[model samples]
Target chain A: MNSIHDMGGMHGFGRVEREVNEPVFHAPWEGRVMALYRALGFLQFWTIDGGRAAIESLPPQTYLTASYYARWLMGLERSLARSGIVGADEIAAGRSLRPARSHPHIMTASDVANLQRGNFERPTASPARFKPGERVRTLNLNPETHTRLPRYARDKEGLVEAVHGCHVFPDTAAIGAGENPQWLYTVVFTGRQLWGADADPTLSVSIEAFEPYLAPV
Target chain B: MGDDHKHDHEHPDHSQLGEMQARVRALESILTEKGYVDRSTLDLIVDTYETKVGPRNGARIVARSWTDPEFKARLLSDATAAANSLGFPNPVGAHLIAVENTPQTHNLVVCTLCSCYPWEVLGLPPVWYKSAPYRSRAVIEPRAVLAEFGVELPENTRIRVWDSTAETRFLVLPMRPPGTEGWSEQRLADLVTRDSMIGAGLVRGP
Candidate 1:
């Protein structure tokens, strides 16, 4: 997430400041659509036990109605099974573990931005923002929230990295009071920088940091 | 909104997106039978979303990450707003997250819970991304899984796997590979493959 392009323009990354933005209102509906799609996706997990075990695990009659995802899963399995990604014996034995990040379709950057700007409160523009090459530090607080400083990002201080303009505060999102942030940034931290001693000396990593999430070093 | 669908008994969801599409299609069919809504123009919106808008969106994101540090900074903050900040229009999500990758730990994203992704920047995720193997294994044993993809990190590299819940989504800023100095933003954008930005894989050196 180093640059704006990576987020799918202004509308998609869940941020938008229009006075009457549409997503904030329709998000829940979309959330439902998303839920249905996800339910379809989750059934893939049970496919491991093969169709029978999965069907058996569900309520007696639920199988008739709840069979959509499992069927999709089985089809995928059968297709892969023939290719030897998983053999037919595995299907019969119900022991098929496939590769990671391998599925049927992916959401693109634009897809994400389409969800932006439904009901989030916009942050007032603030001139105080970080810039590339400035020094900064991650915050120490950890509440149940949308925090930019991961457990890993915490306790480690690095350069200001890149001040990525602005955005709605994720803290807002966590509290159901999501306010769009006004600016964004990317901070470069060496793996050695984040994890001292054990960190790979030659390896360096950059972290995307939001304005409210950082302070001057 | 009423006649676009012919009411296919199969794939009910295709008809679920309001009757407008179905109605439009129905009208198109009638028009075509009676000579109206030319075949080329009939799928205007559909074609635009698939071919014109989708890839163009990809080009914008790929181009920006390579050229401007300032823009990159804005992106890292509020992913959605950053695009708007730089003048791009509506993207998909209500929330955006930017995950950074470093030498010691590579950042990859997965929605173990769902298909939460930052589509605006990364374009479409490949088919395999939504698979259970990537989501479940990535959080549990990311090192081994990444290895299969040929991205074998050293044992010491602490893999911090993110399981994106429905509320939060993620995008990755892959490290710019070496030896690509003096390249244009378009050139740099070419390296921004779907997986690398998602943390499932990295864009390799040219």
Candidate 2:
């Protein structure tokens, strides 16, 4: 879905501010929110892609105004309610009203010690259609469902810098379709190609695009 | 309004912070009540990131790459295996790619669609990294963005912005600064800041 979160090349955001000696998190709650997000993942409540989709699906206004972890909190609530793990009324009441739903796994101290980062790579279904140094063009796509292709790079031509093997396609994974792994490539585009005549010539952009999002130029 | 007088003038975000605190606490309680989450597990997760893992891990890798050409070659060719050889495995199925910065070229990393970072190496991303300004402009006007970060490059040097839109994560291997000959890897590692690895800033000379 085309949302404010796909903020590549669009302007009007103010100057970047760097906080000196910034802590890992600002507040205690922020750490808890981060932990909750990871813990939820440990329990296999939702795929990482699904969590990202939930955050992207937020209304543009809320999406823009919410802080980083605040967005996480909102997405968690949305995912939980959507999956029927917790009811909307229960969230509103600030407590669980129904009996606990049995889950195949629950996060424990041992699980926390053994937590590992999710690997989306899968066995390739077929050989890669494109190769390094090959010219390719990104397909212009705007699906209502989850997609990794940013709006700015749509329909742009690029050179394949590297073929990153097969990985889970988020478009299918986010909607519960399946892993649907595709050949992923690192495609490089000149700044002029992406941003037009005013772009600085020294700039180049490379995006990791799945094969489904690209075609022969 | 009666409550207006109670507002803390110095800390304007006090109320908003309270609201956020309540919301997160409520959600944790709900999850715990449903037996989905353990409070101890949450504490452990937070503690792990807070103290155990961070950019020091990446700094060590960068410093080693600076001193050891073979390790650098392996890191460039197969970053995942190289990092794992040093006990720094990337999260599950994700691949790690190390883009080196040369005198004629530079590398920057961003996630335009969402905040995808090499957490196992560089830890969680900074606030500006996930902000709209950096994500929106880094690809189009990288020189200007680097200028804001005090990294003014020569006009002839090329800038490459890597938008991590897939499962692959990037780490910018900043060029080693000069005048630090015979320096120990520990000393070099101390000079490797997190910002330099993200391509937002350059490593300064000793």
Best by DockQ: 2
Largest lDDT belongs to which candidate?
2
User: How well is each residue in A8-58 modelled by candidate 2, as lDDT tens digits?
Assistant: 997877677677888998889989999999988776767889999999999
lDDT of 1: 0.46
- What candidate 2 gets wrong by more than 4 Å, as runs, is B1-12, B88-93
- Candidate 1 lDDT, tens digit per residue, B76-117? 767666655545444545566666677776776665433445
TM-score values for chain B across all models: 0.69, 0.91
Candidate 2's docking class is: medium
Rate residue A193 of model 1 by lDDT: 65
Candidate 1 regions with alpha-carbon error over 4 angstroms: A1-217, B1-49, B52-59, B85-89
lDDT of 2 by residue, B1-206 (tens): 11122122112387888988887899899989889888998998899788867899889889999999999999999887777778743332248899999999999999998899888888888888888788888987888889899999999999999999988989999999998789999999999999999998899997
**Span of 10 residues, lowest total lDDT, candidate 2 chain A:** A109-118
Q: What is the TM-score of chain B in candidate 2?
A: 0.91
